[model samples]
Target chain A: MNALTTEKLTKAYSTKVALHDCTLAIPQGSVVALVGPNGAGKTTLLEIATGLVKATSGGATVLDGLEPGSLAALQRVAFVAQDAPLYQAISVGSLVHLAEALNPIFDRDFAIARLKEVEVPWKRRVGKLSGGQQAQVALTLAMARRPELLVLDEPTSGLDPLARQEFLAHLMNQVATSGMSVIFSSHSLAELERVADYLVLIVSGEIQIASPLEEIVAHHRVVVCAPGDLDGRHEIEVIDRQLDVRFGSHLVRTRNMETLRGLDSHATTLEEIVLGYLRRAQGIRVLEEIGRS
Target chain B: MDIDKDSLPTQQDHPSPISFGLDLRSGVPTYLQLVQQVEAALRLGHLQVGDRLPKVKDVVSSIAINPNTVLKAYRELEIRGITSGRPGVGTFIVVAPPTISTKAFDQLRSELVTGWLRDARGVGLEDDAIVALFHSALSESMYLANSEGSRSESDGDA
Candidate 1:
């Protein structure tokens, strides 16, 4: 079964559409990286899935077809929001205890042990802890539940590189042992490149790309061809293009290698593909404006 | 069940505590890095046939990477006929490592590569350009040889 599946998941805030008919299925056991530009509805999608906000239209489901934010689903799915919010006045020990009290299946020993492993002082108030430490505490609280699926929204944006690596390493260790699926949204493509086997890219409130990292990298190519060489290829879609007097640079999206024959082509990296998609989306908007004018 | 370390050959034959030794900052894809490291270890005589590889879970937990990445690396090795997975047991090395002897030949090969790279760099050729040239040359020769062999076979049939 998929860890999460969304069908036509849509959301709007007054006049602005946060997510538009977003349909995606994230397979179980995948460490997926969810990425997009600012205001591309990444937070909205997560919020809708977690049931923080009601979707304008359509819906999403978590582990084993449980509706997001439902009682049973909440027990199986853990979400650490971007802020990693915790009660400021509560001591770290109290917070851990609170998690145990709230969740019937919470692992008390694991929580304490993880905190100790990270050297987070149990007596210190959450407000007094460093951002990284507090994030760790938050993660421990969520992980202590031993959920089947974990959703993190920009969980490491506030962390230093070392802290981020440690956090990811700990999460991966857990995943390896338990076979839990993780979906985390982050702006750090480099970190994602290392940890994420699957990638989900959102653009302009839409699902731009969602596939395994290897497949995505394999299907896209940066081919430098002559200006008129790609004219008749209806099967190929150019995601981004740059033209010079000497060469026509096109980021072509296709799995067929035969079409790219004799062209100076190279496989594209994740960052390059993401940037190309974003650039292409912006270019389309510009073209739409020109058409309207 | 995990592979029994005690049942394996001695340390001189196969290195204990097998590792991918991945360079996360090197910008190579993680799975490819894992594959290359395994091949490199085999080539260096650090891993031998009949040696048990680390379990996927162990690599994932130790390296803090997705299990699929390790699986992909292992799958690549399996496709290349270097390793095979045993049901209910861990993956095992099945193929013998290619023997590399004569230190003088190794040094000579490295010297030639270094000198060729220096000349290429002197000509303002980038690493990518050098790789592309080498790859094209290799592919062209292989393609020509395959076609020629096929033609000779057809002639014999006729």
Candidate 2:
């Protein structure tokens, strides 16, 4: 069963549409990376999936066909929103107690043990803790619930490089031991490349690419050749192109390797692939606006 | 001069004989780097036939990489018959790669230094160019050997 699925999930405010007819299904046991430019519906999609926000149209389901925000879904899905909002005024110990009182599934011992292991001062106020410590507290509380799926929104946005590595290492360790599924949205492509097996690319409130990371890497190639060399090749879909006086480098998606014969084509990193798609999406939006005008 | 055996480190305290290191900037796939590291260790006699690989959880905690990458590398090693996984136990190296004798190693090193290195420098190749040339040649020959071996095996099967 899929961990989460959205069908025609659309959300619109008074002035702008956040998500538009977005359909995606994240398989069970996948560490999915949701990436897009700011205001590209990443947060909107995540909020809808976590049942924190109501979709203007369509719906999202989690954990084997349970509707988001339903009691059952809430029990099985834990979400750490952007910035990991918690009761800053309370001490870490109090926060733990509060969480235990609110959620029956919350494991007090587990939370305490994990916090101690990370050297988070439980006696200190949550507001007094460092950003990394607060994030760890939030993550520990979420994991203490032992939910089937964990959703994170920009979990590493404000963290330093070392902090981010430690945070992800802790998360990956839990996943290795517990087999809990994860879906997170972040702008850190390199970090995501290390931890995510599935990739979802969103642009302008629309889903552009959703596939396994390996498939994306295998199908996309960065080909460096003269400008005239690609004149007759229609089989390759050029996602982004950079041209100089002597050479043209094309980021293309093509299944037939033979089409790139006699050209210097190499595998593309996730960063390159995401940047290429984002640039192409921007170009398309510009063209559409021009056509409309 | 009394030494307490109980204070000394024990094998149980350090279960894994080998630890993994990752180079994210190497441009090679994460799993392949791990496999190559194990192969290199085996060839250098640093890892023996019975050496135990680290647990997936331990590796993930240390390296911050997806556990699937470690699992994939171990699976690849298993496929190559270099390691075997015992359900509740740990993955252990099953086959030791053939090691070059010290005399042969020394001879090969001297030949490379005197012949290939001298010839490349004589041709005015810089250090970077020489290194690049060496890697490309190595990969090309490995690729050729792999393809030709598979082709002949298929022919024999037919």
Candidate 3:
């Protein structure tokens, strides 16, 4: 069963639409990476899935078809927001105690042990700690709940390279031992390249691609050829193209390598794929603005 | 006092002999990278038959990759009949990969250095160009082999 599934999910605000008919399924036991340009509704989708925000139409379900924000779903799913909001005034020790007092399943021992391992000062105020330490403390609390599915919104945004590696290593170790699923949104494509197996690309509040990372990397090829070389290729699905006076580099998705046999093609990195799609989306927006004007 | 130290029970639990490193710039999938490392270790005699592979947790902690990727690599190795998992014990190298004899290895190396290296250098190919040309030739050969349908592993596509 899918850990999380949304069908025709839409969230529209008075000013702008956040998500439009967004439908996707995150399989159980897979580490999914949700990526998009800033304000592309990644946060909205995550908020809706974690029950923090209500959808305007359609719905989402988590863990055995439980409705998001329901008591059961809340118990089984843990979320860490982008900022990892914590009580700045409270000590780490106090926060741990508070979490234990509030949640029946909170594993205080595990949280304490983890915090100690990460060298987080239990006596210091949460606000006084470094950004990395705060993030770790937040993750420790969430993990101590032993939730079936952990959803994180840009957990490594402000972390240094070492801290980010340590955080993800800790997370992967937990996944190895506990077999819990994860869905995290990150702007760092290189970071996601190693840990994330599932990929979800959102553009302009719509889902552009959702598939296994392996499939996406395998199917997408970047071909640099003369301009107009790909004009009539019906089999190649051109995702994005950049043209220069000398050459045109086309990012095309095709399952058959035979189609690109004679082309100067190479494999694309995850960052390239994400940027290509985002560029295409921005181009479309520009064209729409031009037409309207 | 002729006790066999090699047969002692205490010697069996040594940590895994090999650790994995990743080259993300290589564009190889993470799991495939793990698989290739194991294969390379086996080929170089660094990992021997019956040697235990690292635990999934250990690999994940060191490499900072998903544990599932490690598991997938071990699974692929098992599928290839190169390794086998012993449930609670750990995965072990089951078969020794085919190795070239020392004589043939030396001869092949000498031939490459004398023949291909000389020709490339004679044409004013620099170090980077020589390496790039070698890799491109290797890839072309692999591609031809793939088209001939002799390579059984699907990892070549990646």
Candidate 4:
């Protein structure tokens, strides 16, 4: 199959298990976002796929031409590490040139122009620029590489809201223009709602779901009702809910939102869907007992 | 990831076969859109058997899809005998494509309709209510498609 497939991949850290029997088949050139909260193994999984960390058992292969860590693989697969590491003395312009020269797929003109679009100065040293600017420069290097699969770990971290928006817009525009696959993991759910095509939700060490981001949003919804009588009757575990006799709302997951018919609806987002999954994975027994009781 | 609408090459003729803005975000896949567009072309006779398909690259460039995705759709059409590929030359629609048997289209139709209906059903709507909603939604979509086609036609003429 000309796809990225991980067969029975397992990873563990001593007695602390992280990613148990996780296997996912991701096609080439599909922008899939890996999302989970802190310590959710999102970073660990990305690290293994990049060959920075070895799998405890099973394996991840990237098509036939590439193997994790094979120079060919590294050349083709770009990793925008959580915090872009740049030599403190390097200027943004020089780093761009360095990246362009090193990467076979580098599109310097596009990268330079994108930086110009963000109005981030080119001559600023990595150490001299603000945090957001550093993030942008890091992102610019990765995008310029134009790899087949760009794995971005917290690509938007440390940026203000506006810079984050700019970064996301640029990331999506590049994906559309280049047909490159991106696996971007972020804590920013609202921003993720805007650009993600696919979502991978991992909690504690297992992938609960991976599907088109839109599908996740569409399938999961929240229904608000005056809290009190309904809590006892909800068949599905409450993902997160607060009911002050004055007002109440419940976030829950169902394959279909048609179950939400009569409730006064409130907000629904992938963030909720993911958090609920995490909660269940962590306290699945408690949730089941609640439901059974 | 800066998508400069102006920076990318723009070769598509205006009033293209597919209109973007006219459609609602129906949450349908692009291949399905291409499938529906081809069917409409055949029904309207704007396209005929032996008509060459626009290059996969061209289709991908115009629509936000991967080249492989366009190829996949064309491959499905070819398997159905609605289209044929001349290796390196492009895909061409074959006249008298394998029996579309109205039923062939029905399955795809039901799938799309059910996507919306299934969600409504999940919310506890009755079958009759879901059916009514489907009709309303389908009519809305058809109206949008027609308006979009005409708008694009004028753009092409210009």
Q: On residues B11-71, what C-alpha lDDT tens digit does candidate 1 reach at each position? A: 3454444776667566578888888887878887888887778877667656767777888
| Model 3 RMSD, rounded to 1 decimal | 4.9
Give the CA lDDT, 0 to 100, for residue B14 in model 4.
26
lDDT of 3 by residue, B1-158 (tens): 23664454332468889999999898777888888999999888899998889999988988799887898999999998999987766899999766679999999999999999999999999999999888767765654554345223344766
Candidate 4 chain A weakest ten by summed lDDT: A255-264
Q: Chain A TM-score per model, please list them.
A: 0.96, 0.95, 0.96, 0.80
What's the residue-level lDDT of B54 in candidate 2? 87
In model 4, the runs with Cα more than 4 Å from the true position are: A1-3, A63-65, A221-268, A282-293, B1-158
lDDT rank order:
3, 2, 1, 4
**lDDT (Cα, 0-100) at A248 in candidate 2:** 73
lDDT of 2 by residue, A76-128 (tens): 88999999999999999999999899897998888999999999998999999
* Residue clash pairs of candidate 1: none
Off by over 4 Å in 1: A243-246, A286-293, B1-16, B24-27, B48-52, B55-58, B78-95, B99-132, B135-158
Return the DockQ of model 2.
Answer: 0.43
Assess every candidate by TM-score.
0.82, 0.85, 0.87, 0.58
Clashes of 1: 0
Error of 3 at A11 (Å): 0.9
- Give the range of the ten consecutive residues with the poorest summed lDDT in model 2 chain B: B1-10
DockQ, every prediction: 0.32, 0.43, 0.49, 0.04
